[model samples]
Target: MSTDLQWLLLRKYNSYMVKGLPEGPIFSKEPGNLVNIHSHKYSGLSNSKTIDVSDENGVIQITTRKTASPHTIASTRSTSNIRARSGGRRALRVASAPAKQGYRPDLRRATLARVSALLAAQKEPKAQPAKKPRGKKTKASA
Candidate 1:
């Protein structure tokens, strides 16, 4: 996925799940469990299964696991390709080609009738003709 899409996914994921947790842990080498990531500063608890993330007063320690959220993987797979095209460029191209003149008469006739009528009106004599100045600039005819 593109960096822009990744950033968008990160933002969306953070908005829905990361506000309660510290900002630094979101991008850490190993993220903890949901409780660890969403706990306050003073909720300290350390063990082999969890890491202690404490703030400056030496009082608040948030417990977290060394794992990512289940939603992260699922969301990435779902939105990676979708967000790539939303960057305002050539993201999606139709697989089917436009129906040719003799390919589908029913559809072609329905569409071309309107187009042909418009074209015929434009071709009438009243339409402006291409011309140039006819005096000095005119070359002698052979």
Candidate 2:
């Protein structure tokens, strides 16, 4: 069976099933929470922008802005050759491609929320079984 649902957490730490991409905020009932959504980029270039969303009583607010970097705008544009462009796209197929035309922050937030919830739900399993007694020593009594 497939583990790491939505790559939220490793199967060892995850137990419950969370939606791969929930239709609404993961914690729709909870209010005033924000999620960050960024484009998927491979290679030297990083995501150019981000979309942040806040939820208040199921009301979702969105904000989008370019990433702040010390580099000038002239240096930030895509300078990679066509082959490089194709290669980067080929990589990280699971990741969403950079929002070409536009990005819907609300939808992105919904998607991110699902992953976030799953990750948050992930809990560490206790190595020692409290209900059971301590294990015998490694060397068996002769």
Candidate 3:
């Protein structure tokens, strides 16, 4: 009888590294764990992209893609590291720093000048029209 089961695939590299020595990369397969799978998915490295797990004849097989080179993976990881280090909010703050540096003082000065002009205008006395003097009543002769 043929049975199908889900397995978790992992790409592992040799922990030991020597200068000027060729590195050996290894692939590992483990029993499928939902929690691990979810975590991997959340990390943006899912089955098709980074991990490769397959089952043949009720046995788990761990394999690596020939197209993905070590250099390419290293470059991709470096870029991700850079992004994680900078962070989203920190990058925004850095980008807006220059604009903010010169903006506030100028804005404050302009606001103060406008307010002072308005206050001066308000303090000036308004001109009024002169009123005509009323004539005294005169007695008329019949």
Candidate 4:
């Protein structure tokens, strides 16, 4: 079967399931061979799975499975480290609390009052005590 026809069949049947293209050329002169490729995104891990596509009796079959190679493990570990460093999970959890409680008019009023107070303080100058003359004060003419 032509690669174009294979691609069309794959698209028609498995477009939602499989996103990225086959690792190498699809069909590549062989009609009944398995082509493996990594997807662009899967389970929050990028390029983490090896997808197998085979033409079985003109039916395009796609299978996606995770590979247990040293590189894949190391990449997963680095991804976890990045997430920890970014504090994404913590920020999401912390932000969700306020959203769940809904808007609190009391809190909003209090925050606005504090902010306006700060702004007013910044706009108004503080009164400075009068300074005495700095010139040397010798004994005044007797």
Candidate 2: tens digits of C-alpha lDDT, residues 28-111: 111112322211221011223433333333333333444346666554433111221233233222112233335433344343
* Candidate with best lDDT: 4
lDDT of each: 0.30, 0.32, 0.30, 0.32
Off by over 4 Å in 4: 1-102, 124-129, 132-142
Best by TM-score: 2
How many clashing pairs does model 1 include?
4
Q: What C-alpha root-mean-square deviation, in Å, does candidate 4 show against the real structure?
A: 24.8
lDDT-superior candidate, 3 or 4 = 4
What TM-score should be assigned to candidate 4? Answer: 0.18
- State residue 123's C-alpha deviation in candidate 3, in Å: 49
**What are the runs in model 1 whose C-alpha is more than 4 Å off?**
1-97, 101-105, 126-142
Local distance difference test, candidate 3: 0.30
Q: Let me know the TM-score candidate 2 reaches against the reference structure.
A: 0.21
Clashes within 3 Å, all models in order: 4, 0, 0, 0
- Summarize candidate 3's per-residue lDDT along 84-128 as a digit string, tens digits: 233434433432332255522222332233223333443448798
For candidate 1, the TM-score is 0.17
